[model samples]
Target: MTTDGCVFCRIAARELDASVVLESATVLAFLDADPVTPGHVLVVPRAHLPTLADLDEDIAAEMFLVARSVAGALRQSSLRCDGVNLFYADG
Candidate 1:
């Protein structure tokens, strides 16, 4: 399910544009349009959930897995960062 006017839902639905880095059945990882760092990304469930409490455990796990993979790629890429940080935000 999805919420009307949800930016993430729009991104997941391909109604909006995002520099997607990773995508799976349950999650989508994309570059942050307004980023703290060059490689900053947002990992989100494809479903629209208002908060973390509303997220399914399986989907949450997948989100992290996707985040991990993205982080590793960022570290190994031309960005040449020694490490990566993952942040979770709910809106």
Candidate 2:
């Protein structure tokens, strides 16, 4: 079963827990509950929506923008990473 609420929704609400790395009015970045590596993170929107088709187009764009911003920051600040890879698991 999924959690008592939507996994993404609860994370958006801050009702559930995840190792969030970055957050904004439209997006949130957190670690994978099941992670492949130490640096893995998941970015999402604040709105409660099951899929990208369920969200507004602008919201989707904003989410992508936030994810890109995080990547840029990581490239600038992280000494170990040459570049960041963002993989959206749902896809």
Top lDDT prediction, candidate number:
1
lDDT of each: 0.88, 0.74
Stretches > 4 Å off in candidate 2: 1-4, 89-91
RMSD over all Cα atoms, model 2: 3.0
What's the number of clashes in each of the models?
0, 0
Tell me the tens digit of each residue's lDDT in model 2 across 1-91. Answer: 3345577878777788888878877889887899776566788777665565767988888878888887776677644566677665452
lDDT at 8 for candidate 2?
Answer: 85
Runs with alpha carbons beyond 4 Å of true place in candidate 1: none
What is candidate 1's lDDT per residue for 1-91, written digit by digit as tens? 5488999999999999999999999899999999888898999888887688888889889988999999889988999687788777875
Residue-level lDDT for 76 in candidate 2: 70
For all predicted structures, in order, the TM-scores are 0.92, 0.74
Q: For model 1, what is the error of residue 76's alpha carbon versus the real structure, in angstroms, after optimal superposition? A: 0.8
